[model samples]
Target: MTTDTAAQDAAMPTQPATPQSRAIKEGKFGKVIRTIVMSVVAIAFLYPILALLLAPTRTEHSMSLGGIAVGSLSNVQFAWAQIVGFDNGMFLQWFSNTLIMVVGGAVLAIILSIPSGYAMARLRFSGRNALIFATLLLMVMPNTVLTIPLFLEVSAVHLLNSFWPLILIFGFYPFGVYLSFIHFKTALPMELVEAGRMDGLSESGIFFRIAVPLARQAVALVGFFGFVAGWTNFFLPYVLLPQTQSSTLAVGLLQMISSSQLINPEEGLNVQLYMPELALAAVVTMLPVMAIFIAAQRYLQRGAMVGAVKG
Candidate 1:
């Protein structure tokens, strides 16, 4: 009887490992691997920004030797003094130019894009689809491709080497229009618009009273993106503004760094901007955009999720 029972037990096959059991065993290992890879990627991205932040607090010689160690605040003050003293205070001029262009362009873009998008989404006009298509085409087109043509157009209008040209070009934001159009079409309730119309509100009245109020997220998104674009615009400003003092920070900073002893050590220019000063300038350039992003972070998040759902 014992021999027969042993033979039967041997004949029976062991239960195969189910998918749930396998997943339970492998999930912990997968999580560990993912965590390690993400950590490595995060470090890789942060290292450069860390180095940039630290560079302004240390002298060029110390930076070359000390890697990314924190240094004294006095070094930062010295760097700022060097930046302020350069080119009869051209850094301040560049900063003011960047500020005006970015703010003006972003505000103009918001004003134009909101109404245009509302018209496209709600109004029954002729050639509306064609207009939307053109906007999409322009949105996909690279800004670099339009640089030469824009320069020529600006020159034709006698607006070259001026702030108006940069502000106008930055204000022509097709992507913002598209984003607004999508938000209105997908996220906004048509019933509210109909109710406004039924209540004797004109198209403009309905737009201002109903559409704009509800589309705050979209507006914020457009404004933020427009500000960033205008703030970081280097090529257009570089091409249009030939004078150094007239240049925005994006163009001026690069020119300053490249012409100084930091980049061209052999050049006989007496300007002695080193890595620390240049790094400080770069940090200063980035601060406004960073502050804007941090302030509008919640709005941006809500805006991004606006048209994600159907209804």
Candidate 2:
């Protein structure tokens, strides 16, 4: 054999085949491309966060002046308000509101999605495929389109000012259902389920006792997405709740901007102060989601792997 051919043959191991070796022998170009793409995407996502973090601080004079105008005292004061608090500061209240929405929505979505996903994936019942197709179609539905109907329904029920509307709407996490379904369908083996049946575990018992534990990766994936969606929601809450006091962080920020002069009882350029506070409040509102992701990163990684390997 030629020297190059011999070298290629030598690179091939003389051991029994294994999944790891098989995977390693696959083309690496895709991995290289993914690495490059991920690096670019990471930078793209992080730059804005870095900018927000590095935003100029507000001093007392800046706060007094009300904004961060060049050579203006209010500008400095506004920056300090970001680090500190604004008049009648409701930053913590807004933070609490956002947390309630995320946590409540995530829990409810998980409760419904896991069962729905399992039913769609494992059950051979009538209309199963139809339901799956319908769910897939929901991904294309504009969330904006759903808001008006949801608003009308909430109005009919007189739930406009309450937090229920926000949480409930986010809980109908169709995408999360699809995600869970795909994960459960692909990653779970049928033999294990049959074994559970042969062991005489009731369907419900088997599902909870056997299947649920194995589906951890998918469940975590769904929960993470549902939580994030709940966190970043704006339009549904805005349209549904018109009361300034009843609004979430997104809608509350809108109220602040729209009624800046009217709301600020203090004599300073309150609008400018509100602007900086707005930016600061945005950062505060997003912190929980950031914390959640950081905490659940291991699960997220596992979930991602489950999807990838199954696909």
- Candidate 2, which segments miss by more than 4 Å at Cα? 1-47, 56-87, 259-276, 294-311
**True-structure Cα RMSD, model 2:** 8.4
Encode model 2's per-residue lDDT on 1-311: one tens digit a residue.
12344476678868555667646554689889989999999998987766454333443344466423334456545554643353355555666777787789999999889988888888789998888888877855778888888889999999887888788888888878877887667667889889999999887877898789998877778889888888788888888868765667776766555555435646454335444455555666677778878998887766555434334
Score residue 8 of candidate 2 by CA lDDT. 69
The 10 consecutive residues of candidate 1 with the worst lDDT sum are: 302-311
Weakest ten-residue segment in model 2 by summed lDDT: 54-63
Q: Global lDDT of each model?
A: 0.86, 0.71
Best by lDDT: 1
RMSD of 1: 12.0
Residue 103 lDDT (model 2): 85
